[model samples]
Target: MKILIVGTGGVGGYFGGRLAQAGHEVTFIARGKHREAIEKHGLDVKSINGNFSVTNISVTDKISDVPRPDLIIVSVKAWQVKDIAQQLKPVIGKETMVLPLQNGVLASDELKEFLPQQNVLSGLCRIISKIDGPGKINHLAVDPTIVFGECDNSKTDRVYALEKVFNDSGFKGRVAKDIQSDIWKKFISICVSAWLAVTRSTYGEVREQPETRKVMRDLFEEVTELAYKKGVNIEPDFVDKTMAFIDTFPPESTSSLTRDVWEGKPSELEYQNGSVVKLADEIGLDVPINRFIYYSLILMEEKAKKK
Candidate 1:
């Protein structure tokens, strides 16, 4: 399969490297020193399962330079999806599939606003990985998995074909029965954990402390309530399930949002917590905790953008 990976950061670098290693035609859209390094010396992936390198692959900074691909995996931050979707217009063939593996639930929706609805697929990925260096990717934890499906949850041959591609590349893949609920499941857990971690507390600290833990629960409930109001059929006991999921995290674990905020870089505060607040306000729902989180970090977010 011919694949184009946009935003070759942690998620894109690792998965694209795997696909390239499997002998699929994979091209990466990257920028700055990362693009230069990948061009000079192939992309390297250091993983717990195994290590591999994707040498002699195409790497470009412009989407216009690449050929039309069978699939385009968008792995950029949530806030960048709209711009990337607009930039992808020239390459989206009639049968081309665009899958978004961003951190939040709004990526596919954002893509649909700019691209054809039939060409967009809702997707989410589970992996703890990052760009270790300019040309290298590090798979730090979790068995990498991708869950995706059609927008309306209908079974399609194209969806299964993509699943085959993922299975052949040596990672876990599943076609979601309910892609929206699956996306929300991930959103609820990540949204709560990320903001809590931003309070300068590790997973251990957040879960162990009574006050912080209570805040975490409130955040989860607020998000889940928003999901219900939006008509997503999430599990009733999802809050308890999310707590159980957090319990499995390593004590010192922190989210990508936490890391970005700590480094004073532009983060996904808008798409995560800010999205919840925006959606809730549209429906006249009061998401006080989420509103608080968004307002608290928005100034810092604006400052990072200035930098």
Candidate 2:
């Protein structure tokens, strides 16, 4: 399949590298030094699975340069959705399916608003990887699952074909019967984890400290309740399961928000934590922990800027 990856960050760079290495015709859309490095050397993926280097992949900064690919993977950060969706007009054709592996729940809707003619699929990627440097991605976990489906929940031939390509490439891909639920479940885990980690505390610290653990658990419950109010049938024991999962991760393991804190970079706090808080208020619900987290991260961002 001819695929175009819109954002060449860790998610895009790693998975797109995997597809390209498997001999699929993949084109990456990136800019700045990262794009330059990929065009000159190649996309590099450093993982426990083994290092992969693919030099034949095509890459460009301009969206106009991208052909009408059969599939497009929108892997950019959640905050870039609006502009990126608008910029995708020229390269997205009617038959093309755009799979967005973004955080939160509004990406597909935003994309559809921009490119109504194209098919926008809702997808969630479970991969612990990040752009370690320009043109370099660090894969930090064993899970490489992608759960997605069509907007209307119909089983289409195109969905099956895409699933085949994903599986054939050696990555775990499932066509979820309820992709919306999948997206919400991911958001629940992500919001809780990101909120806790944004405190500049390690996972071990958050898990071990009774007060911190309680706060984290409360936050998780709030998100789950809000998700239910929003019509997503998330698992009842989602919090317990997610907490147990986090306990097994490395003590030093942190989320993208925590990574941003450490590196003095901007975070998607508004889209992640801020989204939940805003929705809770609209629905006449109170989520104090989430609200606290959203504003706390804002203060951190401010401090970083002043420094």
Most accurate candidate by lDDT: 1
Could you tell me which 10 consecutive residues in candidate 1 have the lowest summed lDDT? 192-201
What overall lDDT goes with each candidate model?
Answer: 0.90, 0.84
Off by over 4 Å in 2: 300-307
Which portions of model 1 miss their true places by more than 4 Å?
A: none
RMSD of 2: 1.9
* Candidate 2 lDDT over residue span 1-307, tens digit each: 8899999987888889989988899999999999999999999889867888999679999877876888999998887888998888877777888999998888898898888734799898988788888889998875788899998778889898889889888687899999999898888878865655566787778888898888888988998999999988887888999889878767876777678766776666767888999999999999999998888777767776577
Q: What are the models' TM-scores?
A: 0.96, 0.94
- lDDT of candidate 2? 0.84
Residue pairs in collision within model 1? none
Q: What TM-score would you give candidate 2 relative to the actual structure? A: 0.94
Candidate 1 on 1-307: residue-level lDDT in tens?
8899998988999999989999999999999999999999999999877988889999999998776899999999988998999999988899999999988888999999999999999999998788888999988777899999999999999999999999899888899999999999899888874565458777778999988898999999999999999999998999999998788777877777877887888998888998889999999999888888888888888999999
